[model samples]
Target chain A: MHLAEGVLPVEWAAVWFAPAAATTVIGVRKLRSKTTQIPQRKALTGIMGASVFAISLMPIPVPVAGSVSHPCGTPLAAIVLGPFVSVVVAAVSLLFQALFFAHGGLSTWGANIVSEGVAGSLVGAGVFLGSRRLGLSLFASGFLAGFIGDLSVYAVTALELSLGLFGVSELGRQWVSLFGAFLPVQGPLALGRRCSPVGS
Target chain B: MSLRRIATVLVFVAVVAAAVTPTALHRGKGAGDYVGIDESIMEARAQEAGREARPPFINTDQGDLLLFVFTVGGLLAGGALGYLGRMVFVEGATSRERTRSMVDGR
Candidate 1:
């Protein structure tokens, strides 16, 4: 549920920009840290980016929401590509979605990126690595990575909305209520995670 | 498979789940019930020079229900993926793998 420019208050949107920029910088630093080979890194980043873009548009029917939106595909990106690279991929894909599809607004792209990019990198990759260490299966690790990555995206999306440009609330209550929309869809998704850890 | 990856996943799950509760619960109210752009408003905005003409999501009863289903599915799927991804992708130590192999052998 990407917010458009006219819907939100300008001031709050402005408030979120700085944090979004910082998030992006963190992603960039992450990308820099992993370049054992620059060319491969770029290629991987490109692959990850395109994959995320395609996945984000995968159009899972929102149960009863009556509209289809794609999975952020953050989990797969993070697990396969690593966090830093996933962030960049998510960021670029989101940029494209905003510009071409009008899926989200340009002014809010940074905030959107933070939720989709940084959160996915951190959560998806984090879980996969951690779970595997604890002796979870590879598929399970991938599933966890993706599931968490997506959740992080949703959470970030909520927090970003909570910034409350329309005088919604200082406490972010306005943003908290949107979780209801995903209920019917999340259960099967979780169970399915047991089978497919990776986004595949 | 590493300690770092596990921690990263958990932290991501915890933070997003904890922080974005409000957002997930209360999304798209403005656009949910939209009948479509107010033609008059769109016209007025068009005259105003630089306004974007975009359609809003109509939060019909069917749509709302779908959104709700999606959210629930998302949570379950995300959580399940988290638990299962860890389980499958991370191979266990000797005992755990041995136990499974032994069970399968029996």
Candidate 2:
């Protein structure tokens, strides 16, 4: 779930926004460069963006933790579209979510993008590439990519929230607390995401 | 049905069952009571400070109107950008082939 608007101090939000903006620029450049190959890729990107929008909206409640959250599709996007393009897709999806669903806040958009888009995409691509290099089958690599990508998003979110709310002094404790609260729901969601053939 | 088909159906049934059973069993606590990460952060902050920390921006009637405007604007901007990006970058083989064929015929 995205941090609500005004949850983070303005400074912290700005701080996170910097990297997200940078990556988005890079992604756009990359997309432009790759546009010559096939129109299908562009179509795929638009379709994937819609998929991410839909998937992120459906929050399933985890009975164990009494928390509700949705599975992120960043890993799948990164695996198909590359990390940079994935970041753009995430940003677009998140922007719509904030505007339409009130799931995330506009003020904290940067932080959410950083956590879900940047961290999730990069880590997912790295894991998928690494798994392929290690001789894993495509299905196995994709599963790991999606599973770890989902978890990493939450981890990054935990870190961001902790830093914003608790500052540098109590970062560790706060991260753990927030992460723990996220785990019960996130863990199952991640597994389900990995097992689902359509998304992974 | 094949095993794969059976498995898919079973999975679908299980998911539906899981989603419905929980809500049926648990009542009184509103859906919002389920602590999302955003609410959890707010609760934690409020606990430490001994005061409620309200969300900075919330949805209002005016805000919804603004959001609708933004959504339409974003959609237009995204579409324009996508079209421009494709025009500038994409070189379809069929179009190139067609051009070559036309030149050769001429």
Give the alpha carbon lDDT tens digit for every residue of A22-113 in model 2.
Answer: 99999988877776676567767875676676576666676655667778888888998999999999999888778656677787789889
Candidate 2 residue B28 C-alpha distance from true site, Å = 16
Estimate, for each residue in A57-128, the C-alpha lDDT of model 1 and write its tens digit. 445543322233446776677776676667677777666566544455666666666777777678877888
List of clashing residue pairs for candidate 2: A35-B90
What tens-digit string does per-residue lDDT give for candidate 1 at B1-106? Answer: 9886787678556644643453355445324432222122222333343445344233222536645644554454455445544443453345477898899995
State which docking tier applies to candidate 2.
incorrect
DockQ of each: 0.04, 0.14
DockQ of prediction 1: 0.04
Worst 10 residues of 2 chain A by lDDT: A57-66
- Candidate 2 clash figure, as a count: 1
